[model samples]
Each structure stands twice: as structure tokens, then as C-alpha cells.
Target: MTQFEALFDGRSFAAILFDMDGTLLSSIEAAERVWTRWAAQFGIDARTFLHGIHGQRAVDSVRQLNIPGVDPVAEAHAITLAEIEDVEGVHPIPGAREFVSTLPEGRWAIVTSAPRALAVRRLAAAGLKPPSVFITAEDIPRGKPDPACYQLAARQLGWTADDCVVFEDAAAGIRAGEAAGAPVVVITATHQRPMDTRHPTYVDYNALGATIRPDGRLQIRSQSTRKI
Candidate 1:
């Protein structure tokens, strides 16, 4: 088990919120596949395109592609649809299903940048049927790094931001959670390196393990191993 797995031994956190893409579902490969195909149609380098917008919204990514005369919104929609249709090998992160099952049903929800359609597809692929309070890209006027998504989710859960613990795999999502005043837990799926530990409010789940206690406080246990 990772350090994160060990941290859940005997601590307490009220509610847990998760980001969908890299946090819970492995949609990076599927995303890259669809994005590369779209970039090729515009004669752009796929790797360059992917690196340039690794954590951006679809519309933001499309606009950054800088393809002359392209309608970013329409292109984003098309590519997103294509990605949903072509999705393969998409699955939940390790221990994700068990973790969710252990938590209180209404105490957890997904707050993701993916549109509802693609989110649904990816969640189904991961064999996860989330609670009804899912907050998608469609639900927010602004995306990650804006804190709107996290704020909306907290409101829907009827919990204050401080009572919520956010599980995120992206730097942008982490920032968003912090901005929303939630304690942020970094799930080390995509981001492998250790982040700055100066902030006490921010903890790496990769370093401390997590588990749901009988009382519903997420137990975070610190282990000998540094990496989660």
C-alpha cells in the first residue's frame, strides 16, 4: 500500500470530493488519443498541443491550439464527443471503488471539468455510479483555478468549504480547492513528484494514507514510506 493508504488508519475528515479525470478515472490516454487525432487534422504537433494545455478546459485548450479560423467552441464540442465515443481502457484509480463504497453515500460527489456527457461515459467505464450531486463543467460558469466548481459542490453538499476534503490529481484542481477554502489532498496519479509541503493545510495523500472511519471521519495515517 502507498503512504496514502496508510494515512487512513485513524484520522477524521468530514466529506470527500473528487475530480473525475485523472483523480478517479484514467482518461488521460483516451483524451490524448482523441486530441492527437484532432491536432493532426490541423497539422499541429500533438505532443506540443498536449503539453500546452495539460490541465485546461476544452474551450481553453482549443483556443490555445491557435489554429487559424477554427471555431474553438464547436471544435471543442466535436473533439469531446469523439473522445467519449472512442474511449477505451478507461478505469477507476486503484482502491477508488472500495474507497467510495466505504464513505457515506451523500457525503461524496464528483467535481470535474469534463462535460456531463463525457463525464458520464468515463464514470461508466470506471464502473462508478456517483451520487446525484455531481458538479460538471456544465454546472459551472468558470473552470478550475477559479474555485467556482468547488464552491458549487460544497454548496450542493450543504457543507462549508472547510468541512470538505478535495481529492485532486491536477495542480490546477489543487489550487481550485485551496481557493475554495477546502483542505486539499493530492492524489498522486498524474503528478508523481512531491509538491511544496510548506502549507500545513495542503497534504499529499500520496504521503499519508486515507481510510473512512466508522464515524465517517476520513482517517489519515502517516507512514514510514515518503511516497504514497
Candidate 2:
């Protein structure tokens, strides 16, 4: 077992980039419903299908699954529509709204592989306001593990990738953050087993022991750890 603290010691992270689904929002069950239904249609194990899709772009995941004669485009569209309409299990992660609201304008943004409309719905359902500038899969040239989204997010915030800290909860997101030249902070909300990244991982935002300092900087004190 290894332990590490995140970049939350009032460091000079000018901005924070967040991934939506498993990071800021606990929308796993909602996502699972979509994937599981697809799995059944393809005669695949639900567990394996779900395991393979986390932190992935819907289109990419659909294409990768390549379920025999399944049309990736049609499959991706169906799943996305289903997810946008279903809010039964969608909610913000603990401490997510509190911590995020404390950030200064332009200091934080959401960069997710979900479509803009779906992202908006999830945020509204969770009672969290979306930042002025939100980046969605539709806006990016490529998905996570490609770094295009994170890099574009940094650009939108008028900052360099190195000036931000990225909060993510999936393998692909971690790789994207690292590739974008930002320090990655992994939230262990999605990955049941040990995360594959060597970056600092925390259970959730509440684990940051986060508080707003008088100087408008974040003060953090937490003993968060991850097995890997």
C-alpha cells in the first residue's frame, strides 16, 4: 500500500480541471444502466462491459466494443440519449459542490467526455452550477488518453496546462492530465481496484480537508491514500 497527498497544500495551481462523471458527479449507476443494457443485447457479461467503459468516450468505447454487427454510431447515440434522459442515480460527489463553488471564477472548469447537453443535465440534477466555460466531448478533437480535451480546457481558461491541477477518477483521464502537462489528482470513486496511475489519489473531495484560506487560496490537509 502506498500513500500520498494531492496538490492541495495551498500550492500555486492557478486553475483546476475536473472530469464530470466519476470525478465531480457520482453518475456510475446511470452509466451502468446504459452499458449493461448494451451488454445484454450483445450477449456479453455485464460486469466486463461496464469495466471496459469507464472514463472512456462513448463513441470510442462503442467502437472498441465492436459488438459484432453493432453500428458504433447508432449504439453511441442510443446510449447517450438514454443517459441524458435518466437521472435516477445521478448526484454530485460528496464535497464536490462545496469545494468547487469556493474556486474563483475562471479558476475551475469541467472537461468531460459527455456531450454538452448531457453534462448540463447532470450538473443541474446534482444542484451544481456549471462553470461559464465547460468543455464536452463534442468540443474536443479527441478524447481522454489523447490530452486534447485537457489542453483545450487550459486554453479556454487562458492558462497553460502546467498552471492547472486536474482532478479525475479514471485511467484515461489520468493519462490525459499527465499528457497535458498538469499534475493529476485521482479520485477513487470509479476504480474499485487500485488505480493504474502513480499520481496522488484521494477518496473524494471531502478527503481534501479543504478550506478556503483568508488569502483566497485553498488550504488542504488530508491523509488520503490509494493501494496503488
Candidate 3:
């Protein structure tokens, strides 16, 4: 009787969409390892560098670092390759298997900024195989915060954006869902900053124990709880 099970006792959602990196799989450690190695190559403090781009895309993160003479695209590519090679400590999120297993096959897909090859490698490392309809960075012209990924996912799932519930841990991902006209259930797995909880389409679930209802609502049963 975990808190999430209690909270999600009676709810129904049409379809569920998940974000791969932090929400469904714990890839932060792998990401940190790769990024730190890349930063060290430039004599930068890995910890400090990681903090500056914690929730951003690899390319965006590289740009922000403003490394003296390094090309952002090249740096991002290098980091991506390193991450693919060193995907240790990556595993499925708690309750991920059970939650995903309960959902109808083909009713959900992973939408992530990771390119196809890397995404596959990470999921494999996590011991989780995604369904057939995943939408990776390679599948979309734009990634999170652009709405393209979510929209494409919804389309592939044969559902309208309004009928899908997006699970994400990043602000950019939430915004992407909102932009795509989908309801977003945010899992606080990584970002520590306070999120804007006022938006009608946004809701936060305590990652300690949370579940997506069949109806698409997120239920989090903890001592302190409130509905969005």
C-alpha cells in the first residue's frame, strides 16, 4: 500500500504518454558522468557545469556553458556519444514496470530529447523496452518546449492531444505538453525549483509515490497533498 496506489484507487485515463530520461528511467547519473567528462576536457568544474544546464537539452546546455572556443554542436555530439558508451546506473523508475504493464499496449510511448540510438541504449540499460510508438529527437524537428514531439506522439497513438496525458519531469516538457494542448502530470524527479502550479493544465505529483489514473489524472497520496 504505497501512497501512489492509495491515491490512484479510482481514476481512468484514455492514454498515457511518458518522458524517458528522468520520469521513467533514472538516467541522471549516466548523464552526469558523461557531461562531467566532457566538461573536464575543457578544464571546467563538472559539478558547477552540470548545475547550469540540469534541465536543458544537451545542445542548449553546451551553448550556455559558452566554452571558449568549442563548438556547441560538436560538444553536444561528443557528450552524447560519451553518454551512450557509459550508461551505467541507469534503471527504470520505481513502479515504472507495474504502471507501464497495466496500460494497454500501444497506448503509450516515450517522448524524449535523446536521439534514437542513444534512447534505445539507455532504455536497454534500464532493462525497460518501450512500446513501438516512441518519439525520439530524431523523430521530431524540434524537441521539448516546441510541442512537436508530443504532438507527433499523440498523432502516432491515434489520439488527439486533448485525449492524452503527458508525464514529464522537466519544465520544458510540461510547456511542450501545454503547447500541444495536452494535460500534463509532472513528476518531481529532478528539477528542484518551484514550478508554476497555477496553470489549469499543470499538476505536480510527489515522486515518492505517484500513479497515473486510467482517466489521465495524476494521484499522489502523501501526508501533504492537494489537487491541481
Find the candidate with the highest TM-score and give its number. Answer: 2
Candidate 3, residues 113-150, lDDT tens digits: the string is 88778889989998888788898876776657899888
In candidate 1 the C-alpha lDDT for residue 105 amounts to 72
Per-residue lDDT for 1-228 in model 2, tens only? 334433444465667899998899888888888788877877887886677687878989888876778888788888889988887888888888888877777778899988888889988988889897799989977888899898888899888887888889888888899999998888886566875667787777775654555765444456555443
Worst 10 residues of 3 by lDDT: 199-208
* Residue 126 CA displacement from its true place in model 3, Å: 1.3
Q: After superposition, how far is residue 128 of candidate 1 from its true place, in Å?
A: 0.9
Which segments of candidate 2 are over 4 A away from where they belong? 1-10, 209-228
Per-candidate alpha-carbon RMSD to the true structure:
4.0, 2.7, 5.2
What lDDT does model 3 reach?
Answer: 0.71
How far residue 124's Cα lies from its native spot in candidate 3, in Å, is: 1.2
Candidate 2 lDDT score at position 59: 88
| TM-scores for all predictions | 0.84, 0.88, 0.78
What residue pairs clash in candidate 3, if any at all?
12-214, 12-215, 13-214, 13-215, 13-216
Q: What would the per-residue lDDT of candidate 1 be over residues 1-228, giving only the tens digit for each residue?
A: 444444343446667788888777678888889999888998887988575454457987898667899999999899889988977988787767766776667778899888899889889989999677899888888788889898888788887767787878777788888899987666666554565532232222333445666765666555443433
